[model samples]
Target: MKLILKACIILIILSNTAIAQRLYNTSEKLWKPQKDEAFLQEIATTIPTNEPVVSVAETNETCFALMSGNIYALKSGKLNKDNSAPAGVTELKNKNGDIWALTDNGIFRFQNDRWKKIDDKKYVDLCMHAGKLHAATSEEIYRLEGDRFVTTKPENGYYSSNMTMLMEDGTQLHDDPVRLGPISKIESYSGTLYVLRPGKLVLFDGLIVNEDFIDWGLLPSKNTRDMLSFGRRLFISTDRGMGVLQGAALKTIKGEEGLPVENTTCLERGFDQDIWIGTERGAVRMLKDEWHYFGADMWLPDNKVNDIAVGNNVVYIATEGGLGVINFEPFTLQKKADFFERHLEEWGHKRLGFIHTVYQKDGEWVREISDNDGGHTAPYLAAMCYKYAVTGDPEARKEAVESFNAMLFLEKVSPIDGFFARSIWSTTGDKDEMGRHGSGGLPAKWYKTADGKWYWKGDTSSDEVTAHFYSVSLFHDLVAKGKEKEMAKQHLEKIAAYIIDCGYTLHDMDGKPTRWGRWDPEYLLRPYGYVDRGVNGLEALTFMQTAYNLTNNKKFDDSYNQLIKWGYAANTIRQKNVFPPENLAPWDDNLAFESYYTLLRYEENPALRSTYLRSLERTWEVKRMEHISWFNFAYGAITGNDCDLEQSIKHLREWHLEPIEYNFRNSHRDDLFVEPGYTSYEGGLKAISPREKNITRGSRNAVALDGGQNGRRIMEPTGFIRDYWMARYHGFLEAPETNDPELTSVKRRTEQQFGAEPYKGLEKPVFY
Candidate 1:
């Protein structure tokens, strides 16, 4: 029934197709302080195994621990191996309540409480499928036909022991017995059979041996010990850490993601659907909620784990020390209070309680509060606004108050009316290195204030404006009460009133609008200001709405309506009409999210809501990869359109866990289609071609980290504290799933904040 051929096709060596591995200097100093305490503190104890454990298996009644070359049965918390127990056992199995062992000497079956020798010949593995016994050796697969083991033949073509890796150009590399080692592992999934050889995966559908294959070298260590599938992803364990394969992409998770080392030994899927890994150093369990690590001296004895098996609530680990068992639960707290408190106090605080970006100088982490201080700090302030507005957590309220007061210092210290400085620094006579980004200072966009003792950045962009207004609006409506609330209202009025009084343009002391701070009729109506008009006009409208919302000022409404009547609303919509492959740039999306937040505040107006919702949807679709949690949660709160709750959480996790700036390259992959030309100004724009690049990204993206700092590293990541609480506030991602009592569902996770929405009677803490 099987067809045999002497030789066949050419080997195709595909280039540029490689798996992703990222490196981060976490122990060193960087832009932010990501202690990963939540990721760290969850570690359970590591048990010591006195013997060298090489393999492990769990049967219904007993657990088998293979150490050195002896098969030991773990019972009553004690390990006992028979003196005649098969030595050099490669793997142990409890098949359907039947104890079986695969050793180099022979295949043995245990029955009636004792080992019964079944076959004297050697075998690699033993498995039963469709009520038939099957065994695999290095070069051949055997099936039981009645009493005799027979070689199972392929239906259409003979699976020859000899195989060739054919190149695309008709060249075949013939190394039959050299590099093409025996089948190490095999598994059947759906209707396809996957066989793992020494350096390649041969997949068959029982009929044809497909030409498609994966490069084994693509693995982090390529010393792949074993593999299994959970959900839609394949879990691969190698000499290095762990890996997950979904579709065409392979993501290698290493030490940066809480992994202690890269030398991984074994892997198994937990009863609770978690991924359990065994390594030379310690054992790791990737729970749905968090990554759990077990260190040798920390709790583990011997430190080297050879095999892992999970039963119900306990993890049975086979280690060189003997055996280690761990009991772990998922970290399921909805609020990350510790992360917020620690990080905000450590890296976010600037001079006089203001917010500033933090980075490392030498070995110490320092908050660079004076560099684009307004832009970096605003995201944090907004996050706190959502926190206080929703939960009324006193800590959030206190931080918000501190941030608000610091922002006020920006205006008070400036001699120019209503002009807020980018940041403040101790008045040194030399040029403040705050604005000196890469090459030089921010191109004359800075000036010393009236006092020689202070300096503030000039030519401020609209990014700072929206951040200040947005945070102030949230504080006014949510946290600040009475006089403090009135202060926020006063601040909003002065900023809005200044813009309106100056013909809808933010004018500097030079009596000229900043380069990107113009929305007056002269700029919006002029042809030269086309690019600025669409975005600026949109921003100014939102700014007015925030002012009106906070102060209930009629003039803010009048100013907002005047722009609508002037056709800037329609113009704004047209200007932001990005579709398909053409997406919103990063800065533009930032502006759009800020615009969405402020515009959606006065949702009582149906017509205005309709106008902005369309633009928001387009922006959300295009910028989905950005995974702005606050933006995503805000949208989910207002519209309930899933901006990908799970991936949104993954994005936040990546920020919290690995905040390094690893370079991502799109030039190589064959699976992704490339969009040619002119989308972005710098570097290159590579979109997911065949289909437009939307938001189907996981923690790993199309971008691959090539070991170095690819671009600017960020200190203040935007999501986490704000968006997470917002999702909870909006009643989107609340209540744990009954099936999985732990871990937030990334895919279905959902959110809110700002304004007094009658509080919904949610619990609140005293802010005093």
Candidate 2:
């Protein structure tokens, strides 16, 4: 016992130490140019090396390239690698028609037929901000005055230091105290200057530094990998994922949600507000509301994307492998509207209703389908299809019918004896292994018990019989629609009888009867009400209602009342947030479980209707507006909250647009660019904090924008309009009020923050 205790203590200490080290250690090695000026004359005589290009600029129809410590000018589309200028250029920018290049030696102006060096004593990072060329160094910030560089302070206040460390490893690399820390890169957006340090991001508004200008912690990542300003948001690549700075808050885009890569290398905004990300792994493009990946398999020659630039409607990428280019026509609002219309026409009208059919075999009842993948059940698809069919579009109706038929095929089960078997292959008589039978067969039936009970099956635990009951309820709803009504009724009767036979009420076979079920025998039942079991109870009640409505049977009402009592007791357990380990079912402990299932059961219980509505609101308040695939009990929660069954679905909508954190590490810089596969930013946001308001506007900066009218207008302006609307459709936010003053303020702030001014010369482009 003493040795075991010592080992546990040592493990805890090691874990804590590891966490602390990870939090504080953000250092990285700085890249040093090999043999200063070696590429200057060498490139002038020999072929250009494969060292990736850093910066590219075009002025007076001449294209100049900055690569591997040397500068080259392209004449007649041919790079002058042989006789290029002998300057180690660091930064390049074009103002009006003239090109300015900042190099290690000094600043130079390219015009007419000369490379005129702008002699200056001090040098640092350079950028064109508010139509002026500004240079920022460790000691001070300087702007061009007449033909010379002059010192200038920001509008608020200015702080200059002789000694500072700015680079990832400046403390060990540079020896000059006068050199203003390590300024890796500099960029100007709207009228503000942004500085990127090792692990920090700061903004200078021509005055004092706004310490709160951007807080990455709100959208935390492992490291500040890379950054880019596009449209109305600032995109930042971090060790874990990518972050977008909208207003004062940073919203993260994780790699787990379909990002091509996580280790972002560079970012650029294109002609149509299209944002391009170049990462260590590949390249990704965000246009309007869609994301596309380009790599070795998709036009890109390599995966190591270093930098990106836009020229003549084409995007250029520099990678370790080679240079690649992609030419894509910009998406338009008309196309977006048409697409949305088509989407709605095909799948908009289906009203999700309560399930009516439940199948019982031997002594256990079962559902018809599972909720493991994307929560697409046959009944759900049918309801969605039916809703879309009501739009008076024949094609939509046809598609809806086809989808409904497909669901029928997916949920069909063979009947046997007075009761039906759980599935075609599995018999309900094998209860011990089958555990809780649902209308749908087990995703994997290999683990079935001899008594017909499904054991700890694939991925999910065995104790979660509520999912099965919910499935039964969903199946029953399909029956009422005149599609297999007889089968649905028969299955419902069998399930009711099975429930009664199982100790007169629903209870886990392995444990004592409580308000909820358990996941497995070894696992203790959670004292918190089981969401899965509540869903089952709700399904039973819905079945009873259907029976009563069909036959006017008092027994159905009695059974429903009993189930409602059970539901109320279970809800009491959940409100306390205390669950005895012994009572926990596989799906019972999740906090969002009960409310999500309750949303579906609202149609059955009119007596306790208000209680269910309140529970939905409370769940929304607690979950915020995030979507967790595991917490799918609320698949229809949004519909319930939106319609008469509940009061407000605002929380559902809020969570749909909330951003979330996926990856949180810096093991490899390449991971910064990897795209998160098929995940929603809003879904992630809700998963983090539930109490966060969906809509908030303050000053010129806001983190999460409510989908108000202003938000919709700016959505297009910022290239996120499609996502904003989709979020609404997915019950992530309330329908936006485009005319609200709060939304107008958001638009103004977005413009001011991004420094986007309407340009007559540029073609009108679609917003995201």
Please, what is the whole-model Cα lDDT of each candidate in the order they appear? 0.57, 0.41
Where is model 2 more than 4 Å wrong at Cα?
1-89, 92-94, 97-375, 378-383, 389-444, 447-555, 564-607, 625-768
Error of 1 at 136 (Å): 7.9
Model 1 segments more than 4 A misplaced: 1-329, 333-337, 346-351, 362-364, 427-432, 437-444, 449-452, 552-555, 577-583, 603-606, 621-628, 640-656, 662-714, 735-768
Residue-wise C-alpha lDDT for candidate 1, range 12-129, written one tens digit per residue? 1111011000011113221121122122113234334565666777766467788777787776677787666666777776554566788777877766777766776777765555
What's each prediction's clash count?
27, 115
Which candidate wins on TM-score? 1
